[model samples]
Each structure stands twice: as structure tokens, then as C-alpha cells.
Target: MKIYRIANLAILSLVLSIAFATAACAADNTVPGWDPAVLRDASTIKVMTTEPDAGEHWSNLWVVVIDGQPYVRLGDRSYVRIQRNTTKPYVKLKVADQEFDKVKVEEMPDMKDKVAAAMADKYWMDVLIRHESHPMVARLVPEAAPPETPSH
Candidate 1:
């Protein structure tokens, strides 16, 4: 009876340690806040990871930071996870080699034109000249939220 009790205590301690270790691993997976400093002066970037069916996601995409916000323009035919999701998507942004995984994404299809006009002025000679002439813009909104930790 004494040996059985000691074994049970050891097992309980092992389980608790496992649980704590798992939690620590999860915490390491996501960033806590929007660190704008990282994106302060980045050039061409691949902002998102492609969905499973999409082929070769990283095309040289330009990023425009306007009024303290970041925006990207994607075409109507673009195969993006954001396009498929009815509600705003959960986004992870990898900018300047740092990953920010706790962002809430919003779609701004209607404001595409307005955003383009704004970008034309801000980016000037260095803007996406081809798209600017056509102006097919898609905007993404990211918010700081509960970190979306990946689960095993």
C-alpha cells in the first residue's frame, strides 16, 4: 500500500510537468503585439502563407504603409485564404524576418480604390506602377488580439 501511494504521487508530478512544458512551448509560438518598428522601412515582402491547394504563394509583393497602417493589393482572381473566409481571418505576418502570429484580419474590398489613390501619393515614383495604372487593390486589416497559438 505504501509503495503504491508513492508511485501515484510520482505519476501526478510527471503529468503536471508535462502540462507546464506544453504551455511554455505554445507561448513561444506567437508574438505579443504589433511591433511596427520591424516594418518601419521594409521593401518587397511575402506577407502571408498560401493555403494548401494554392501553388507557389510568394510572388514579389509590395507593401504600402499609410496613415500608420499596412496595406496590400490582391486581384479578384487571387487565391487567398482571406478571400475564402466569410468572416475576417486570423492572419500571421512575417515581416523583416520577425513573425507576428496574433493578428485579426479584415477585408477592405470596397476601399480598394481609395487606398490606391492614397498609395499613389505616398509611394510616388516607387509605387506598384502597373497596378497603380489599373488600380486593382485589396486591403488587409490586422489587429492585436489573443495570440493564436498552434495546437498539436
Candidate 2:
């Protein structure tokens, strides 16, 4: 009887853990667009990307907001992986404590100079790498949820 009770308690805990994780990731989309202000104060965000042959990996990246959109600039290796992933444009992001599971990554070459200026303004450390030519800027836009249909 005691063993059965213990097993039941363990199952309950597993269920609750999954539920909490789902809720955390569901706060993902403030879609239409991310107000740059939402992530403006956040210095860095965690980017989760799937490698070509392996599973997903998370990298910490400095974030900057321009015209109410969030953008991150990655170094060569990360940039190469993104280019390889031509089919899927989505990546996961964690800003502060919030996790976004379906954030689309759009590379904006035309905004290169603007993004650089914004990063330089937000991160004083930008001066160190700004001189080098790491020009891949990926804008993070959350996926909007589908519209709910009324019941028949």
C-alpha cells in the first residue's frame, strides 16, 4: 500500500511539472509584433537553435530593440548554422524569465547599420566588436496564435 501511494505521488508530480512547463512556454506570443520596450531593459537573451546533425543548443546573446522590434547579432559559427537552415526560419528565445518557443528569425541586411547603431547605444561593449564585420542581424518576431472559431 505504501509503495503504491508513493508511485501515485510521483506520477502527480510529473504531471504538474509538465503542466508548468507548458504554461511558461505559452506566454510566448505577444504577437502582431514585440514591443521593443518589452525586451529593451533586458541586457541579454538566450537563443535556442537546432544544430544540423545534433539536438538544440542555447546561446546567450546581447539583444537590442529598434523601431519596436528585437534583434540579435550572432558571430560566424551561429550565422553559418542559420544560413544552413534555409527551410525553417523559427528559433526559440528566452528573455529574462519568459520563454518563447516559436520566434521567427528574419535576417535584415538593409537594417545592418541601424541595428549596429542601436546595439552600440545599448551595449557600450559593442565598441569592441563593432569594428569587426559581424553583420548578420536576426530579428525575433513571435508567432501569432490562430483565431478562435465560435462553437456551432
Whole-model lDDT, model 1: 0.56
Off by over 4 Å in 2: 1-35, 85-87, 145-152
For 1-152, candidate 2 gives per-residue lDDT tens digits of: 99999999999999999999999888655564455676888988887778777667777888888876788887887786666653359877787667877788898888888888988998988889788767488888888656789999
Top model number, TM-score: 2
lDDT of 2: 0.79
lDDT of 1 by residue, 41-74 (tens): 6665554544656633434455676555667665
Q: Which candidate tops lDDT?
A: 2
Please give the clash total of every predicted structure, in order.
Answer: 0, 0
